[model samples]
Target chain A: MKILVDTLGADKGYEEIVKGALKALENHNNLYLTFIGNEEEIKKLVKNNTDKINYIDTNEYIKNDEEPALAIRRNKKSSLHLGLKALNEKEYDGLISCGSTGALLAGATLITKRLQNISRAALTIVFPTEKNPCVLLDAGANMDCPPELLVQFALMGSVYSKGVLNTNNPKVGLLSVGTEEGKGDKLRKDTYELLKNSDLNFQGNVEARDLLSGNSDVIITDGFSGNVLLKSTEGTAITIMGRLKKGILGSFKAKIGALLLKDVLKDVKNMLDYNEYGAAPLLGVKKAVFKAHGSSNARAIETGIDAMVKFVENDIINKIEKELAKKEIEE
Target chain B: MKILVDTLGADKGYEEIVKGALKALENHNNLYLTFIGNEEEIKKLVKNNTDKINYIDTNEYIKNDEEPALAIRRNKKSSLHLGLKALNEKEYDGLISCGSTGALLAGATLITKRLQNISRAALTIVFPTEKNPCVLLDAGANMDCPPELLVQFALMGSVYSKGVLNTNNPKVGLLSVGTEEGKGDKLRKDTYELLKNSDLNFQGNVEARDLLSGNSDVIITDGFSGNVLLKSTEGTAITIMGRLKKGILGSFKAKIGALLLKDVLKDVKNMLDYNEYGAAPLLGVKKAVFKAHGSSNARAIETGIDAMVKFVENDIINKIEKELAKKEIEE
Candidate 1:
C-alpha cells in the first residue's frame, strides 16, 4: 500500500518526520511512502539515496494560525495541500499529516471532498477506555453541527469502529448532559431521535460520566462538545498523572514504592497514551486521511503510518461507502 | 448563623441527613439548623435534639425526572421549595440540599429569586486542580446563554472565588476550544469581547486542556459547555483512578507497591474528591443556595452545610449584590 506523508508543521520539524518515515518503512517491507516536503532537505536527510522512497517537493507550509479555508484555497504549493491533492488524485491509498488539525480537515474536505452519500465527514479520535479504545467524533471538524450532521457522525463512527477497532456492531451513543431521552437541548433531543431510528446499535443518550466506562463503542457529538470532552479528559489525565508523579517524588516511602511500581505506572501511562492509537481518521473524505497529533514524535508518526497501512489494507473507505449506501437505501 | 437543611432526595435516607446536620453543628458551635422534611422521620433521628436544631414538617420531594419549572410551581410543599421559601423570607441565611440539580436551581430562582441586576443565576462548582481549586460555572444551569449571561457568570464566579475560595481579585477566563482570540464559535467570540471589557480580572480565552492546571481561578462558559467540561473532568478522574487501582490489584508487585504508597494514593484521591469541596453554589440568587451532589453521603452533606455556613457568615450574597449593583451604577 502507498501512503503520502506531509513532512511539515509538526513540532519536531523535518528531521523527526524523515526519520519516522524511514522507521515506518523499516518496520513494514510492503509499505511504500511518498515524502512531500522540500526536495533539498529530503535529499540531505536521506543522504542523496532515495531508495524505495518517493519524493514530492514543496517548501511552503500552512501556518497553524492561518484561516483553514483560506490556507487551503491559497496555499496550492504547500506540502499539505499538495499531499491532499495527490491523495484525491488516487496517487496514494492514504495520507498522513502531523499538521494543524484545522488545516488538515479543511484541506481534506475542500480538496478530497466528502464521500458519496455523506453530507459531512467527521474527525474521530480513538482514545483508550477501561475496557477498550472508543471512537469519539466529531472532534472539532464541524463545530456548529445540526441534527443531521450528528447522525452522519454516528454513522461514520460506526463504520470506523467496525473496520478498524474490530468491534462488530459497535454500540452508538449520543453524548448529552443526562442519559435520559429528553435531557439535553433542542439539537441533542433531535439528534437522539435521529440516532434512535437509525440501523446501528443505538444506546440512546450517554452522559459524560459514562464515557470512559466502555458503555458505548461509538460516541457521537457535535464538534464543539466532542472537542471539549476530549480536551477535558486529556487535561484531567495529565493533571492526575502529574500529581501522582509529584506524590511519588515527595515522600521517601512513595519513592521506594515507585521503583517497584515503575513498570506498572508505565503500563498505565501507555494505556492512556494517544501515541499507541496513532492517528485520528478524518472519516467522510473521499480518500483515507489520518491526522497525527501536532506534537507527534518519531514513534507517534510511525504508529500513524501503521494505522494508515491498516486503513488501506482493510479497505476502510470502501467499507464506509458501502455501509453509508446501505443506510441511504434503508432510509 | 441560621441555615436551612432540606432532608430529602439524597441517596441516603433521613437518618444520614440528620446525622450530617448534627455533624455540621458539631463543627461550628454558632450554627443553628432548620431541618425541613418529614417531621416524624426527622424527629425519630433527632430524638430530643438540642436547642440549636429546629425541625419543620414536609414530606414532598422533587423527582430527578420532573420538569424543573413544573415541579417548582406544583411542589410548593416540598422540602426544597419550602426551604427556599424560608431562605427568601430571611428565616435562614442560607439553604443546602442534596437534591436534583434542576429542582434546586428552579426552586432557588423562582422562590429565592435572583439578586438585583442579575438576569440569570449560574451554578458554580469548585474542583481540585494542579495548583489549587478553581471555580467553574454554569455547570448545568442556562443551556443556551447569551454573551451577557456569560459576563454575569464570570462576575458571580469571581465573587464566589473571593468570598469562598479566598482568591482575591480572582483571574476569570472564558473557556473555549482554543486559547487564541477569534478561535471558537460565534458565542465564544462574543463572550470573549464582553469579558475583555469587564472590570473583573479577565484572563481571556482558556482551552479545556488547561482547565485542571489552575490557569484561571474562575472559568466561565455557557451551561452546555461548562456541564460537558465538568462531567468530562469527573469521568476522566474516575476512570484514571479505577485503572490505577485495577493495575495495583492485578500484579503482585503493584499490590505491594500500592500498600507502601497507600497514603500517597489516598492523598491523591482526597485532592480530587468532589465531596471535599462540599456543594456547588447557585450564584446570582438573592440568598445563598447550595446544591449538594445528589449521591452525597453523610460526610458530603456535612461539608455542604459547612459551605453554607461560610457563605452565610461571610455575607457572600450581599457582597455579590453590592458588586453587581456597583457595576450597574458605573455603567
Candidate 2:
C-alpha cells in the first residue's frame, strides 16, 4: 500500500519523521511511502531506504501561528497541502501529518473533500479508559457544532469504533455536564434527542466525570468541549505524575519504594501515554487522513503509520460513506 | 456568626450532615446554626450542643430527580427552600446545603436575589492545582452564558479569589480549547474582548489542560465547559488512582512498595479529594450560599461549613458587588 507522509511542521524536526517512516517501511515490506519535505535532508536521513520511497521536494510548511484555512489556501506548495493533494489525486491509500492540526484539518477538508452526505469531518481519537480504549470525536476539528453535526459525529464515531477499533455494537454516549436527559447545554440536549432517534446504540448522556470510567465505547461531543476533555485529561495526568515524582523523591523510604515499583509505574505510564495509542484519524473525509501529535517521537510515528495502515485496510472511508448514505435513506 | 444548614438532599443521608454541622459548631464556639430538616431527628443529633443551635422542624425536602427550579418554587417548606428563605429574610450570615446543585442555585438566585449589577449568579469552586488552590467560576451554574455573563463571572471570580482565597491581585483567565487569543468558540472570542477591556487582571485565554497547571489564579468559563473541565479532572484522577491500586495489588513486591509509600499515597489522595476542599460557593448571589457535593460525607460537610464561615468573614458577597459596580462605572 502506498502512503503519503508530510515530513515537516512537527516540533521534533523532519529527521525523526524520516526515521519513523523508514522503520514503518522496514516492518511492512509491502508499504511504499512518498515523503513531502526538504528532499536533500530527508534523503540524507533515509540513507538506503530508497526503493519503496518517493520524494516531493519542498521545504514550504505552515506555521502553528498562521490562520489554518488561509495558510492552506495560500501555501499551495507546503508539505501538508501537497500531501493532501497527492492523497486525493494519486493512488496513495492514506496520508499522515504531524503538522499544525488546524492546517492539516483545513487542507484535508478542502483538498480531499468530505465524504458524500457527511456534514462535517471529525477528528477521532482512541483514549485510554479504565476498562478499555474508547473512541472520542470530534477532538477539535469543528469548534461550533450544531446538534445535527453531533448526530453525524455519533454515526461516524460508531463506524470507526466498530470497523477499526473492533468493538461490536459500540455504545455511543453524548458528553454532558450530567448523565440524565436534558442535563447539558442546548447543543447536548438537542444532540440527545437526535441520538435517541437514530439507529445507533444510544446510551443517553454521559457526564464528563464518567469519561475515563469506560462507561461508553464511543463518546461524541462538539470539538470545543471534546478538545477541552482530551487536553484536561492529559494535563491532569501530567500534574499528578509530576506530584508523585516529587513525593517519591522527598522521602527516603518513598524513594526506595518507588525504585521497587519502578516497573509497575512504568507500565501505568505507558498505558496512559499518547505515543502508544498512535495518531487520531480525521474521520468523515473521502480519503484516509491521520494526524500524529506534533511532539510525537519516532516510536509514536511508527505506531501512527500502523494505525493508518489499519484504516486503509479496513476501508473506513467506504464504510463511512455507506453508513451515512444508509442513514440518509432511513431519514 | 449565624449559619443556616439544610440537613437534607445529601446522598449520605442527614445523619452525616448533622454530624458534620455539630463538629463545625464545636470547633467554632462563636458560631451559631439553625438546622432545617426533621426537627426531632436533628434535635436528637444535637442533644448536648443545643445552646448555640436552633431548629426549623420539617421533613420536607427536594429530591435529586425533581426539577430544580420547579421544586424550589413549589415546595416552600423543603429544607433547601426554607434554608434559602431564612438566609434571605433572617439574620443568617450564610447558608450551606448538600442538595441538588440546580435547586440550590435556583433558590439562591430567586430568593436571596443577585447582587446589584450582577446579571447572573455562578457556582464557584476552589480546586487544587500544581502551584496553589485556584478559583474557577460558573462550575455548573449558568450553562448557556453570553459574553456579558462570562465577564461578570470573571469579575466575581477575581474578587472571590483575592478576598477569600487570598490570592494577591489574582490573575483572571478565560477558559477555552486553546490558550491563544481567538482560539475557541464564539463565546470565548467575545468573552476575550470583554475581559481584555475590563479592569481585572485579564490573562488571555487558558486551555483546559492548563486548568490544573495553575497558570491562572482565577479561571472563568461558561458553566458547561467549566463543569466538563472540573469533572474531567476528577474522573481522570479517579481512573489513574484506581489503576494504580490494581497495579499495587497485582504483585507482592508492589504491595510491599505500596505499604512503604502508604502515607505518600494518602497525601496525594487527600490533595485531590473534593472533601478536603469543602463546598463550592455560589457567587453573585445577594447572600453567601455554598453547595457541597451531593455525595459528601461528614468530613466534607464540616469542611463546607468551615469554608462558608470564611466566606462570611471575608464579606465576599459585598466585595463582589463592589467590584461589579466599579466595573460598571468604568464602562
Q: Considering every candidate listed, which one attains the maximal DockQ?
A: 2
Per-residue lDDT for A1-331 in model 1, tens only? 7889899888889878788778888787787778999878877777432566798898888988899889988989998888988887655788889888888888888888888888777889997887878999999887778898888888888878887789988999889898888888788989888888878899998888888888799999988888999999988888888888888999899998888788778877987798878789999987789898888888888888887787777888888888888888887
Candidate 2 lDDT, A223-266, residue by residue in tens:
99999899999988898888888889899999989877877789
> Compared with the true structure, what per-residue lDDT tens digits does model 2 show for residues B1-331?
9999888888888999889888988878789999888888877776676778888888888888899999999999899888888887658889888888889988988888888888888899999886878999889888799999998888888888887778899999888877789899988899999889878899898888888788799998888888999999998898889889988989999999988888888878877988988799988888888899988888988989988888888888778777777777877
Candidate 1: C-alpha lDDT: 0.85
Stretches of candidate 2 exceeding 4 Å from the true structure: A47-49, B47-49
Please state the error at residue B206 of candidate 1 in Å.
0.5
Chain B TM-score of candidate number 1: 0.95
Estimate TM-scores for all models. Answer: 0.94, 0.96
The numbered model that scores best in lDDT is 2
Q: What is the Cα-based lDDT of residue B174 in candidate 2?
A: 85
Interface RMSD of each: 1.3, 1.3
lDDT of 1 by residue, B1-331 (tens): 8888888988877777788878888899788889898877777676444788887798889988898789988987888888888886746788888887898888888888888888889999987887778999989888878898898888888888898778978999888888888877778889898888889899888999999788799998888878899899898888788878888888899888988888888888987888888889899988888888877878888888888888877888888888888888988
- The DockQ scores of all candidates, in the order shown, are 0.69, 0.78
